[model samples]
Target chain A: MVTMRDVAREAGVSKATVSYVVSGSSLISEKTAAKVRAAMEKLGYSVNHTARALSTAKTNAIGVVTSFRNNGACFDLSAGAYLYGIAAAARRHGYDTMLLTGDDGVEAIRSAALSRRVDGVVVLDVLIGDARVGALKESGIPAVMLGSPADSQGVDVVDSNFEAAAVSLVERLYDHGHRSILFIGWPEAVYERKLNYAVRFRASLMEACAMRGLRVGAVYAHDATLGASEVIPRALRDCPSATAMVIHNDAAVVGAPQAFERTGIRVPADLSVVTVMPDQLGEGMQIPFDSVGIDVDAVASHTVDRLVERIGDPEMSARVELLDQPMHVRGSVRAAHED
Target chain B: MVTMRDVAREAGVSKATVSYVVSGSSLISEKTAAKVRAAMEKLGYSVNHTARALSTAKTNAIGVVTSFRNNGACFDLSAGAYLYGIAAAARRHGYDTMLLTGDDGVEAIRSAALSRRVDGVVVLDVLIGDARVGALKESGIPAVMLGSPADSQGVDVVDSNFEAAAVSLVERLYDHGHRSILFIGWPEAVYERKLNYAVRFRASLMEACAMRGLRVGAVYAHDATLGASEVIPRALRDCPSATAMVIHNDAAVVGAPQAFERTGIRVPADLSVVTVMPDQLGEGMQIPFDSVGIDVDAVASHTVDRLVERIGDPEMSARVELLDQPMHVRGSVRAAHED
Candidate 1:
């Protein structure tokens, strides 16, 4: 409750001098500034963030709108990692995050935006032609999408290029003499939702296979763990002739090696597996599986940069950024032979 | 901006009636309330959260202090799950969460608390004689600790009963005819830091073993995953007579089954493993290991309840709450000797 006037009176200085010292707006003598700071500290004076935000029209808070629908039921590893990245970035920039979960409807988004609870919004799992994006644009609020919709307009997007990454994995399999490859993707990404990058990756894989005269077998897994016990066996049984498999899930990859062991299949000899998500495969949890390491740290850094940029200049033109995927060839893939 | 005056004029009602309609206080006639709502909607009038918060002196925002030091690492599954539970609970209560991470020292906590950035804080991994706890209490801020410290002077705590849970598991193992068991725990929890519930569980296991005239072998794991790979093999080799293992780490349990497999040890036949964690394990990433499920949801709900109570009545005395740990028997532990 100590005001600038109290600090000035205690320090025998003018209120303007106290304000300057506290705000660091102007140069003040070191001794005077110290005196004011000591007096303010002694009086238990703290900056009122709410009042400061109201006066400056800057909340220094970012709104994170996350959907628990679609693949949101999956473990918090993926989405949580992105959020952790954003939070870390925001902290570095002296900002805080306010999470808005399960805000599906357009009205909900508009309400959140108009309420002025946050200065900007970082949206995850944004569908093509998302209502939230439209609402944010209409309300003149800065918005950044974790993934872009098919017809992106008036929104900045920062997402991993899963489709291209999938294609690259398939090409690697093809180059290694894999004539037929099995593709395991998440179910929600393939069936119920359109925001899934795994589904797009599957389509791109099939397209690339068609152009190269290759056969691609696909299956939808409810999750990575389930995929390990259920889908991997089915993939092997249905595509016995297939020599390699491409996985777009980290959880699935972790269980795939065990699945192979259960079926008495030797990795890189009888079958091969690769994953599109690399961060989930932590340093010590390596599965000897070849992978296109999706640099999660880089993805996080880029998303933070994009969200900050959008926040700083809400009127700036919307943009879609696609980062390149790097491949880490471990011992999972091998050359297929014709018997 | 359409104020209450505008709604009153458009709806042909008094300003007090419009205010009553918006605040839902002193209920107006249904017809009059509907008319006021319609007029406000037509004029695009919305309640400003900032102004409302100022008037009510309630931000409806909870602060969650999570450290990323040692066991508080970002990728720690249990820590992440705990945070997720808190966030989900806050969302269900129509509240937003503001996470404050990396606030290690007293100064950081003091800044966060005195700034009034959040209504209350949910503190995780609280240490014995923690400086942050003292600072928070001194600031008269509402807080709930995920784990109970040995000393609880001015804070509410919600934690699992580790000793009883460990004893129950030991008894179960004894009933299954296992004479010797190996207990693996986190090194940081046991040595570097003072005794926590995990350490207490180890002590109870030792006491139970002593009571049964059997010596239990124990080892400290650097982390769950590391212990899974390194400790499992060592336990088998070093304590060749041991037939069962109780693991407290979730990540380590994920690989424990695999580690046993690598050593050509059959579960239940060569060794039995039981972990202590939540039953949900994490959606989509379920490990097949048997476990004693800690009611994490209950813990989270109770913590929130206690925090709200403390916030509403600051004069209420602080207390320690220890909840029972639910045992979830899975396929890991079996009869030591097949009848």
Candidate 2:
């Protein structure tokens, strides 16, 4: 029931100053803005967002499209981290986030675009041949992607350098004198769905090992049902000469220490181990390990920054940015002994 | 820039008919609505949500507030499942979800209410004496909570029956002829924060055990750093005669089988184990266990349904609803041996 005029009168400011503050204009000074905000708070003046948006042609909100479906089937833990990042960054920029979490991703994106409820969009869980890419482009809405899709010609994308992560993992082990190493990968379904990160990591890891002339041993999709104790021994049996291991699965890494205890393989004594996962997951483990952590927050921050920049400057060029991953050493590796 | 008039002309219908379809009013028949939609699609007519909202005072969107903060410190995985459920249910009701993931819970709700960017709100990860509850009441917004706060009067709340779950766990273990039991609870931080579910479950479990005259042994807060293997062994040492275990920690449960293997304690042979967790988690494990599964989606659906109903009918009475949890039998329990 309260109006901006009442707030301006209460604060001893002009109506235009109150308007500038409500519209989030940069023209207002911090002191003046604070005064106006305090006045608005005292007067309990709730903004009519619809009317303000109609005049300014801005919603002060962004759409975040993810693949957390209706059937409760697909939930990517790592993607959720990125989502958390965007929301926080958006809040910092004085914007809200509108989320689209249905399974019909393309349709959802199109509908969000058509309605113009948000100023921009952030896409997550991008696939190799993602249909949402075309829909986003067709909508002509400013957008950013968390995953680097197969063909991202005119879209802004920010992701962890999975290739660099793979190279770093292999080189860390190779430098430790590990020639024959066992590799543990994500589940088969991850590759089948063509999730960009999973596909990129596996391919780049194989290539990196090949380039160094390191013999890569058996690779198995981590089955959560079968804990690491069951899979690690099987992988070792396939590569009896393996003196180290590299893991890319989050669930499997949780049981790696137990697996080592059961197999009588001492860490850094008989075999070295390294895992590539989110830093939170890596650090949250009871027994930490040498790991290459994907800074998911960094990627999300970059995506949001670029999108906000593009929203302000419509003519800005699209870019693909990949951040370097940090490797934490916990003394899980040692120099191998020659027989 | 195609207008409703243009679409109506193409579809051979009145402008009012097209307006009804765009407003999502139930006055129009499905056949006529389909025709109008097809015409609008062919003409590339995108709705201007702000203008329409200004006219109708309806945004057709709901707000979801969660504590997935910017620092990347607090992400509750179980709460994420409930969020997924709300998004799906909102879409089914022809609504979109706006996410507020900032840590400033009270301010976020107040701002969201003042902005009027969403028609309703869904609050997740509620605490015992949540400040957001007061903010919601002050804003006079139609909102629902996923957790039952200590003072949830005049607000709609949907949650899993943690008390019933506790009773069921104790009775099942008691029926198996187990006289002594070891309980592994959530971290001390959970109780310190007074998360309603954790506090309620612990109290209910203790009471249920006392009622049946069961000797509950050493209760340890699950330490993820030490793992279940270390904690379980230590818990057993305190209660050497314990013949059963009840685990309420997600991270600790992941290492239970390995813990049993290390201590040479066979499940259902020397000890029986029961877990209280999300159904998805219990079902996702390669080796499933007997558990009390919280149907997160059912709770979310009910929350959304109640919120949407209240949004339509402002005078609807506030109610607290608790859905029964499903008990899964996976043969993890056995008859106790008598000396």
Candidate 3:
């Protein structure tokens, strides 16, 4: 309950000097700042953030609106990594993150902004034509979307280019002399929800395959029901001539070794396997496979940077940013002629 | 910036009535509350949370302090699950979670509490003799610990009983006529940090093995350098007679199939495997294995409940609650006689 006045008196300085030091103002001399800090420590004086926020009309907090609907027993690894990146970056900028996980993302975001609980907001798991985008624009809050919506009007967007990764992955497989390929996608539910990343990846991969005049087959693998074990064999059976497989599902990729073992398929011998997922997930897989590594940290870091900039200058123009990740060739692809 | 007075004048009600409605007080009549709400909507009068917090001395936000140091490219699934649970629960109680992740946990916690940025705090990944425990106690804040420290004087704790799970796993293995067992634990770095869960699990497992007079060999597996592929083979070589294995590492359990395939050790054929992990992780494994299922949701839910309670009534007594999780017997373990 010690106030700044008590510290100022103890340090033999004016109250304005104590305030300047507490607010990190560069106007104060180093000696004066040190004296104020020492007095604050001795008097156990701490700044009341609420009162300061009221006076400055700014809260050193960011609202992070994310959805956990798709998460199963195991939380989504990619989402978790992005969240870690955001929290770390926010801390570096002297901000805390207020996590808002209400099922209705638009309402959650709108409320946070209207209440002035945070200076800016970060939206995660953006869907095609997401309602949150409209809400954010209407709220007039400095906002950033971790995933791109089909139509983003006023918010900055930072996301991994899954569409590019998908297209590039197909080209790599085709260059390996693989004429026919089987593409395993995420659960039907994900696409049904109109999640931008999965839908975009599937469309881009198919477009790339058609342009190459390559024979391709596709199947949707559900995490709970149609897992890798069932999806992998069914795709192979339907496309008997397929010599390679491209999996865009994290669970399917993690479970690939078991699927191949049960179906009696040898990697790079009978079939070539490539996955499009974050490198973090690929590293955890029991067997290494060729992958287009999505850098979740990069996307998150950029989103935070843009949002912080917009918060500082609300007139900053909004733009879309799609980061290109690396392609890791871990010897899981084989030449069709050799096979 | 429409103020409460604007809404009050538009509604033809007293400013105090609008204040009561904004604070969610039941003293306001339903008709007056409806009028105030309609006026607020028409005038676009949003509550200024900072000003309200200065007057009411409540933020309706909880601070969640967690560490991500152990995470590699992939985030820890269990920690992520716990975080999701806490956020979901907090939202249900009309509270947002303020995530504070700093390497110096004590400083992060003390700053959040002393600044009154949150109504309460929930600390994750508590270490043995954690410095944060002392800081929290000294700060005299309403706090809860998701993991128990060796000396928790003034905090409520909610954690899964890893010691009990370890003891039960050993007993189950022993009952299957296994004498010698190989136990692979988390990375050496985790133990070096004195993480409460890993340190407690290892100690309890060793203690239980001794009680049953079972021969056990232990090794620390690092996620980066000494991964499962290297640790599993080395442990097998050192404990050649080991007919059973208890793995307390998530990465090691995940990579068991690859290690077994390379080492020519078949599950339930050459060795029986039992893992100590959350059921969420157990379900994600390509190969299902025997495991003690840690209910991360239950722990997180209880921790939030207690923390909220303490926030509401600061005089609430502190107590420790250890949740007993279920054991799942998959096809990974087999009788030694059958082998």
By lDDT, the best candidate is 3
* Residue B291 of model 3, lDDT score: 88
Residue B334 in candidate 1 has what lDDT?
85
Ordered list by DockQ, greatest first: 3, 2, 1
RMSD of each: 2.9, 3.5, 2.5
Kindly list the per-residue Cα lDDT of model 3 for residues A209-245, writing each as its tens digit.
Answer: 9999988898887663216877789889989999999
TM of each candidate vs. truth: 0.92, 0.91, 0.94
Native-referenced TM-scores of chain A, all candidate models: 0.92, 0.88, 0.94
Task: List DockQ, one per candidate, in order.
Answer: 0.47, 0.51, 0.51
Instruction: Report lDDT per candidate.
Output: 0.73, 0.80, 0.83
lDDT of 1 at A300: 68
Which model is ahead, 1 or 3, in terms of TM-score?
3
Clashes of 3: 0
**iRMS (Å) per candidate:** 2.7, 2.9, 3.2
Where does model 1 exceed 4 Å of error? A12-17, A27-32, A69-73, A103-108, A188-190, A223-227, A278-280, B1-19, B27-35, B69-74, B103-105, B187-197, B220-223
Name the docking class for model 1: acceptable
Span of ten consecutive residues with least summed lDDT in model 1 chain B? B68-77
